[model samples]
Target: MQRAVIPLKGELTVGDDYTAGDFFDSVSFRGVQLASDDNMLPDSLKGFAPVVRGIAKSNAQITIKQNGYTIYQTYVSPGAFEISDIYSTSSSGDLLVEIKEADGSVNSYSVPFSSVPLLQRQGRIKYAVTLAKYRTNSNEQQESKFAQATLQWGGPWGTTWYGGGQYAEYYRAAMFGLGFNLGDFGAISFDVTQAKSTLADQSEHKGQSYRFLYAKTLNQLGTNFQLMGYRYSTSGFYTLSDTMYKHMDGYEFNDGDDEDTPMWSRYYNLFYTKRGKLQVNISQQLSEYGSFYLSGSQQTYWHTDQQDRLLQFGYNTQIKDLSLGISWNYSKSRGQPDADQVFALNFSLPLNLLLSRSNDSYTSKKNYAWMTSNTSIDNEGHTTQNLGLTETLLDDGNLSYSVQQGYNSEGKTANGSASMDYKGVFADARVGYNYSDNGSQQQLNYALSGSLVAHSQGITLGQSLGETNVLIAAPGAENTRVANSTGLKTDWRGYTVVPYATSYRENRIALDAASLKRNVDLENAVVNVVPTKGALVLAEFNAHAGARVLMKTSKQGISLRFGAIATLDGVQTNSGIIDDDGSLYMAGLPAKGTITVRWGEAPDQICHISYELTEQQINSAITRMDAICR
Candidate 1:
């Protein structure tokens, strides 16, 4: 149920080249991007994000330290809290917070967590700007005007910085980077970029590129390397999307013929290369039989011909019920020197732990199954096997089904898939289907995404919403029902869309008095929001429909002053006291009205009560009235 996605990607490769991409998540500092993930400091180097409010008097247990370690811990639910997803530390300490409770008590607090030198942390600033138009179908309708800008800046001591630039028409580029934090030996970064191009006037391309990065966490060798980057460029770098498609206008050059001026394309010559590159990402943990990873990349080119490499290594573990993994890969190209290796292994098992039962049955609702096996070997000798099976229908598994089979080299294959998810009452849904076979061929596929939220009582559409959301505007009541969201109701123009809130915290939104509409009058059934991250808030539920009376009055006949004061047209509506048989229960009145009752302090102790109602007593239910005060 982790929502938020705006991914739309299309790719067709195998030397055919066709690509389309779109990604999203926003709060506009150019931060937030998901569909797998992003934003690890981008937006010119992010920094300046605040919000860490708190409170909790009972069911506590919150943690959150900083310096003495322990980044965050949870379990709240008592009241007032907001922690905006932490993580920004580059020194400037101060977080703390403890709070244990549930009776055993424990408490502590602190929360300042500084940042400012490049400014960031006072509401962490991250920004991004982009403009687009880059159509291609062999460039016939030729279009190209894409722009970009990014920034991030967490400063002061452990530093952090970022920069950005880009443009099309004749090309341009800029870049900057710096990261610090050294203490026990780890964390370093450096970046540089510069580019220029002229295209049509032929010959102008300039270049400069450099990058280096490293990260660490040894903890006495139970290591955690994270990343180690490298890059270099010289041979006249040219990137600004390769100088607007290598001098556009039907790119065709041939002077000193490198096989008739082929300036690159085999999908951009395997990802933009004019000179050097290297990349590495690392990971390791292995204490309880799990964790190990290494990623790779390499490239070198000038007149091209060879020097490209790829590598991978992986391992994950679990026993006691089986789950394991292994991986290996190697690729080489520079005219391929026979390097294209692969090795793999994976296993997963969970058929309810092989029938030992005990999923806690409350009269059936638990059904589980899972099995997976994958094997591979390659470098030409070929070998592949893949098998999978999954079934989980509800019990919070949100309905699922799967089947797959495979046996290598374009032969024997089978697949089947099914998915269903629902969150009831009004929206939030997911559906999927897939089927495939080879050996005479057959294929089927389907996918649909969701998310639509509008405010002042209108559009709703559900499911996707995670970076934060709201939009429950209850205008004319409509279908009502909203209570903590899930299949949220209200539509037919009353709005609904509680999609997944929780960004700066708080979040609570109730209102299900049997889904309203009985002459409606719910002046606040509950609401609390905090939002921010990828905000979209707007929870206004002050419902109001007409005539709901319950009146008893008297003045010349005495009985008026348990606390008198009432005014309908002049607006005070109902005031203090007045209810010891001087009945009062006035909701959104107005079926024809006049109510004016006052008490003591002379002035003839005011009284003016006249009422007329029809239209079936203002639409049914609570409508019993009688008012008379001289």
Candidate 2:
């Protein structure tokens, strides 16, 4: 579900009034069951998956697989591509990615994947509901309203039962599954989804898809199967997204237009249906020596002969202060002429290890620097080598810079780049410059980012905010630093905003008492807040603005009896009991005030004392004075 409000006549600027325009408020709801292999949920809720990254020398087809199962297949233009949306069959398994270049060359690499078992405690339940309209980037696509709901219940005897359904005007789907906890063996789950759809041509299609997933960890063998799964769908199976496309006008024949036109091609690509997929991700630990991992997948289409495949693995280890790694990638896609493969080696060493013998503090500080090198050779024997140095600058390590030089044997061209990043109290910034000798080409990049929060109290500038934030309010406590924050402090209004607060959980917001002004006192320095998603919660602290006073009161020539009560006549007065020395130490004192002293209930036991503070004493943080009670 989503909602937005647009001002029709007035500008909708931040920190501005929008009273003149009629607002256009819209609320939209839609629910959909994505293809079994696709998951758009956030990483936290979907569990963890390894990101597959690769460089494509030309246009290519990228396929991601795990546990011998192809989980994802897509096309990419020339350049670096990062695949972060791979849906694994299991919770743990290495991912193998294959990139088939337009020239038929293929490259493959392994991404280590591991995650905790997805076993819920007995009797626990998890559920989600979504209501929204069909959404697509293409304005020409048909749209429909839909609803979806899913449920998971942890049953008795280490079993989990899960089911879900999706409903729409023309499409409907239902799914059910069961998962088991195998104790020492591992975990496994199997599910099936049945879907029915009515196309614009009035044709009805019905099908079912079956999936199996497994995960395990062999502690003694040091082998972990993060994910291993397989899925197969019938020819008639069409996801809701696909069903919507089928309902579009002229989607089947492009309105009698040429079959070779771009419009026809778009329709064909959008209608391509999945047939079967296999994925596997695995990793083995070499005890203290290091670790290695392997991941791969294979996928096939329903109508076309094209198939996508990927395989990748790598080994990494550390020796003293030096870290080393070696990896190989292999990829192949049907219709591509040749397979692509790449071999890479990389290492890094801390400069401090070599400079520890020096006694100079500056040199020791610079020891945080690291020297790194990487070399990769393609199947055609083209090699690229890069050397770089990176180091943190400030003592807090909030500022860092790196410089790198590279040489490509294929072009015999040399290139170098330098970049710096700074994480400040209120913002983060980055700058970079890159130049290549090939064409004397130079590029400059820079960025500055921060977050602003507006609340009833006021607007506050802060570091990059997350989904949730907390606004700290401690009036009169200006310039007081926040705990656990880098150089973050309250402004003159004694207010500051802290970002990245976790939703549905308690977040501790604390102030540094030591940083408070001498004349200011805080009744509470810490507060706990729980904010909802995208919510701005206020955390208020009770702060008193006044002087601290230690006053000795006497009746006639003798000091007041101990245990006597003293109360000042002001809103911010600090009331206290007389100490053994006939003096009372109190905070939040006014410049001049009347104090009422009482000990016993008898009428004669009470006395009133009038006291005045000197200019010097009033200006001081702590004032010492004498007072007479009549």
Candidate 3:
């Protein structure tokens, strides 16, 4: 336990420094006359802060490491302080003190303490922001970009503020968006302001917008619940051709070009859930046998007006699981995109609704043969939902599923499947057919045929790296982008690391031979080459011999560099991190194989390389290309 040791005696003095926390935090000097040996407390300092007006007792400074972050340094000034509040993030840290004389010299010590979650009494705050590299195609380079920034606080309830932007190449062109919420009243977490945006050249549908999520749990784990809301303006998702406009009310960045931004407009929503058997979620439910979820949306615009609704429910109560889910929707326009509106509904369940891990609290782990399983169903049916069910019979617990589907209008549908996850291996596959009322559409579906671990190998690069995970800007949920530099190996396919918070496979970039480089001063730290892709004579790996690698370009003449990086081990799930510029300079031999290299122009140019491993050295000439690919 901590005891307040304020009020000391003796000619009190300090070198213009001696913070309240500096003194009170010291156990040995608890009762010592805090004569700063000559400085006096300023009138501006009082109350929670250590002050000296009609007072006595001096103090020393202290240091602490709650969890693992060190939160102390020498140099104190009397001011408001709290000891127990340091660990108000999750309950686990230490409290300590230090002492310094009138001189510049310093000394300090620590007192251990338990961790604590965010405490309302302490007024502590915890939050994270991410900036992502947004793209729209298989090509690694992004021509246009969209971003989101979110700030959340902790308390009895919580509060959040978020904003987004879509940069079309360089201009903050045409766009549109919206914002709103619902939750514990006054608990800002639920009822705060939110805005999704659409701007110039960008109307409602084709332009860029985003979704807002509200849940009860901080980590969104265990028996949890949440409320979800999204804004999908009817704008052209994006534009490829010039669009003329005659505004209903021409405004700056306005999407008066209804047809251009014509999308299923504004939608308001509510959701709820529970994890265990007999789980409950807003308008949806799930049980030990299986699970189900519900979702609905609508849209409105100038030239056209339409409304659609869907209520889907499903569960797996048996093996060859007899599960079912249904959906319904309708649409109508005045004279085909001129004016007027209409509404309708259709209900049916798909053949089988393949599953995924529902991030909602209403989802839970269930005992299968030997392992455990949790499932979530994709409700991306806002544009078009189908009536059918999809099933899976797994051997291990590894499999992928896919299917094609559609409803109303000229829309096409698709579904994918994954199966049998067991003993570290499983079977994953998918199948889909395009359903179009007009013409034969394309079916761009994919499925994994082999077994591979969901876990990724480590990224080991020697020191000389920048402070890892720095928020260059607030975009998506990723705060940092990690690189995989597993030494100079032929088989090592290096990949650009995204913030760990990202769904890796879904929205990530690949490192290659045409766009990787090392900083001029920091030879060990890999840098990225913009324009992501362009054929250049990049520094490919050498054979099992002394290889002088060079990444030459048709534009910048020629340059050469060598050395690979390795992934570091020991990173936890929720722990925040920053990269260490540990060991930078080292000379290593290049190996056999096509060493992929990257060379590009400013801004967009980035890199992916491995820190040559120190623990292992055999002049490894033929190494695993895992450093370049996975």
Q: Which stretches of candidate 2 lie over 4 Å from their true place?
A: 1-120, 138-141, 198-204, 219-222, 246-272, 303-305, 333-340, 352-368, 437-439, 513-522, 543-630
lDDT of 3 by residue, 488-586 (tens): 111223322222211101222222222222210112233332211111111212111122222221213212122222212221111111113211221
Evaluated against the true structure, the overall lDDT of model 2 is: 0.68
- TM-score, every prediction: 0.29, 0.72, 0.25
Worst 10 residues of 2 by lDDT: 16-25
The local distance difference test score of model 1 is: 0.57
Put down candidate 2 lDDT per residue, 1-630, tens digits, no spaces: 111111211111122111100000011223422211112223344435566766554335798754334568986533345577664323344455666754344555545443433455588655544556754434345657776666667899999888878788888888888889999989988878899987656678898888787999999999999888777889888666565664434433323335443322133343346788787888999987999878787778777887667777888899978898887777765444566677778788988655556645646442378998877788999876778888877644678898877776876877667888887767889998776655377779899998777788778877788657899998888888888876477888898888878655688999989888878888788999976545688999877777788888789889999999887776533477998889987776677778888999898899988877777876697888787888
Error in Å for residue 257 of model 1: 48
Which one is best on lDDT? Answer: 2
Task: Give the 10-residue window scoring lowest on summed lDDT in candidate 3.
Answer: 49-58
Regions of model 3 farther than 4 Å from truth: 1-150, 155-293, 302-304, 307-630
For residue 328, what is the lDDT in candidate 2? 76
